[model samples]
Target: MSDSTAAWVAAGVRSVIGAHTQAQDAGRTDDVVALYTPDAVLELPGMDPIEGHDALREAFKSWAPTQPQLHLVTNTVVTPGAEGEATATSDVAFLQRGESGWAVHLVGHYEDTLRRHEGGWRLHRRSTTFQ
Candidate 1:
């Protein structure tokens, strides 16, 4: 891919990541699942790897917070590859609001594999490592 094409792919990958966090934070389970491929896999820190869109939807719904929550994603680095594939790593700060105030709930890094789909870029696999 040319440098310009690579740049565009990187931006698209980052957008997908950002959209996932935003949708989840807003408790939009369906929207969050839409960001992934139909057969996507989500691996959180503790639980087993949740496979496919149905499982992903259920997992996100079950984890919906009672209070406000936010996921701050930063330092995202995307590596473009052949065949419409890419990988990304990002630092994430998961925050939740309680009676006291907003506090950090978890600190983690994400390793993600993405692919260009008919609709757009979608996450094929996402693995989180908590710190």
Candidate 2:
């Protein structure tokens, strides 16, 4: 792929992470769900895959009360595929406030599949493996 194509794909992947962090921090479950495709699935270790936006919304609701202080996304690697599809992997660090202040709630890596949707990229599948 050309440099521009690579950059564009990378940006799209980063946008997904940015939107996710913003939505979660704002406690907008619906907005968080909107970052994925209608039929998207999210898999977390030891839990059933969260299938579809509705299920995603419910899952987010259950977790929102924790009031995460921050969600950091880093080390993103995006690989373009044919037919407007791409795969991305990134490290995610989640923090929450404790008596001592912000401490890590979770640290993980996300394996994601994204597709071009309405002139932008949207995640179709994501699997999280905690570190």
Judging by lDDT against the true structure, name the best candidate. Answer: 1
lDDT of each: 0.93, 0.87
Q: Tell me how far the alpha carbon of residue 43 in candidate 1 is from the true structure, in angstroms, after superposition.
A: 0.9
Q: List residue ranges in candidate 1 displaced over 4 A.
A: none
**Model 2 misplacement above 4 A:** none
Sliding window of 10 residues with minimal summed lDDT for model 1: 39-48
Residue range 20-113, candidate 1, lDDT tens digits: 9999998999999999999899998778999999999999999887899999999999999887899999999999999999999899999999
Q: What is the lDDT of residue 43 in candidate 2?
A: 98
CA-only RMSD, every prediction: 0.8, 1.3
Clashing pairs in 2: none
Q: On residues 1-131, what C-alpha lDDT tens digit does candidate 2 reach at each position?
A: 89998888888878887898888887889888888888899999999999998899999988784544787888889898887889998899988887888899789999999988777788899999999
In candidate 2 the C-alpha lDDT for residue 95 amounts to: 86
Error of 2 at 103 (Å): 0.9
